[model samples]
Target: MITDLANAMSRCRRTLWQDALGAAALMVTLFAGLHLPALF
Candidate 1:
């Protein structure tokens, strides 16, 4: 039972980390898209 719980926790952590990275990448893309137009 403890091993199963530990495995679940690790999976959750990995999912959270992936989500955070995706969100950060999205934000960076959006910021660049919004600001890049002003350079003209």
Candidate 2:
């Protein structure tokens, strides 16, 4: 049914959004880790 397809699409979109946020956080963590030692 169309409703099932819509639900699947929404779930996929949410998963992708979460993955993007996780990737951004990981990048920020890595950037901070690499630079924090220099600041001390």
Candidate 3:
């Protein structure tokens, strides 16, 4: 039973990490899109 709980927690952590990385990538893309044109 304890092992099951640990496995579930690990999956949740992995999902959260993926979500964080996705959000970071989106923010970076948006920042570049908004600023890149101004440089030229």
Against the reference, the lDDT scores of all candidates come to 0.92, 0.93, 0.93
RMSD of each: 5.2, 5.5, 5.4
Residue 20 of model 1 has an lDDT of 92
Residue-wise lDDT of candidate 3 within 1-40, one digit each (tens)? 9999998888798588888999999999999999999999
Clashing pairs in 1: none
Question: What is residue 20's positional error in candidate 3, in angstroms?
Answer: 0.3
For candidate 2, the TM-score is: 0.67
Please tell me which predicted candidate would have the highest TM-score against the true structure.
Answer: 2
- Cα deviation at 37, candidate 3, in Å, is 0.6
- lDDT score of model 1? 0.92
Model 3 residue pairs with clashes: none
Tens-digit per-residue lDDT, 1-40, candidate 1: 9999999888798588888999999999999999999998
Question: What TM-score would every model get versus the actual structure?
Answer: 0.64, 0.67, 0.65
Estimate, for each residue in 1-40, the C-alpha lDDT of model 2 and write its tens digit: 9999999888798588888999999999999999999999
